[model samples]
Target: MGPPALYALLMLAVPLATIFAYTFWTQDGLTIDRTLTFSNYREAFNDPLYRQLMLRSVWIAGAVTLATVMTAFPIAYFVSFHVPQRRKALWIFLITIPFWTSYLIRVFLWKVILGYNGVLNTTLLGLGIIDEPLSFILYNANAVVITLAHAFAPFAILPIFVALEKIDRSLLEASRDLGETHLTTFLRVTLPLAMPGIVAAALIVFIPTIGDYVTPRLVGGPDGLMIANMIQTQYLRLNDAPMGATLAVLAMAIVAVISALVFLASRLTARIWA
Candidate 1:
């Protein structure tokens, strides 16, 4: 391999190796020793709290992925097939403009909008829509899902749009010539061609959402907490490095397995289409 590629691999290898070693190693309250053990993993599995956190994380991430993809597909479709080529790039850029700012700021903006006395509540109260501010809108699992979905929407849109743009216009016309309805053409041609982009978008959103700590920590209540939040607590507040490392490793494993399943499913779908 080239020197830059070798150096990049070496850099990644060092930290990953350290994390793996740390997860297996034993630790006291403050210090970790290099003694290998499975006790940390056992603790993670045995703890009902961690299990719930992990399940919630996966659920939230899945929800975000589904929501973003469902919402993005239509916008991407319009941009790719209906909009003029000259305006397509501008439309896509406008869609992604929110991401130019920090992710934390964007999520926090949602918090402000959803807060009990925030914009929505103020407008509603001023217009006499409700007597009291809505507390359930923020600081919940739903809020986390919504906020993360908004944050990841652009990531989902750009890839799907690119995939749609890459498809040959002739193929779509040919499908129509064969007496296929628009819906049938979409199902048989457009969707299959867009699979790679859909997979890419899913990975971009789901993987990071699974490990996201910011949105959950800022807006999520106790029940909305994810595995990443717990992992952070273990490392910083609890000062249990081994347990924290264990949670990190578990999160990585979960992401890896889910990603692999997505890849396999996509391949299977492609094979069936072929």
Candidate 2:
């Protein structure tokens, strides 16, 4: 590997090793007792609060992944099947325009739109649909899902679009020649062939959303707090690095299992396609 590669490995290795070591150690009054022990992991698994938050994070991440993939698939399908090839570039470009803005700005804008007396509430008020702002729309797990779905939309879209684009046009024609309807052809041919992309999209959205700190911090009040927020609290507010490291390791292990399942699903898709 080149110098940049070496540097990258160096940066990745050190912090990872440090965190792993911390998981084995215990925290004591603003100082870490560096002697190794399994107590952190023991406490993590035994604590109901830790278990609840971790599961909640994974569940919210799953919801975000599903929402983003469902929303993106239609747009990707439109671009791949309905739109003219010449206009496809413009459509993809438009999808990416949001990327030009900062993620923090996007989250803040969502807060504004979803907040009490924000656009959604004010519109509802002006239209006489409701006399008061809907308090349920923001500062909850629902808000986190909405924000993360919006944030990860493009990541889902691009992979799914690529998957749809690479599909052989002949397969659709072959199905049609056999007297298949458009819907049937899509269901039997296009959709199955596109499974790998959908899986990829799901993984992309699922992995990062679980680890996201900012969205949960902003939109997720007490109800919306995810595992990452808890880990952040442990490290920064609670001054418990060992516990934080333990949570981080546990998160990665869960995500690793998720990734393996997705990979197996993708391979199964490929075999079915073949």
| Model 2: per-residue Cα lDDT over 6-32, one tens digit each | 898789988888888899999999788
Residue-wise lDDT of candidate 1 within 169-204, one digit each (tens)?
899999999999999999999999999999999999
Worst 10 residues of 1 by lDDT: 27-36
Q: lDDT (0-100) at residue 33 of candidate 1?
A: 79
Model 2 spans with C-alpha error above 4 angstroms: 2-5, 269-274
Clash count, candidate 2: 0
Q: CA shift at 266, candidate 1, in angstroms?
A: 1.4
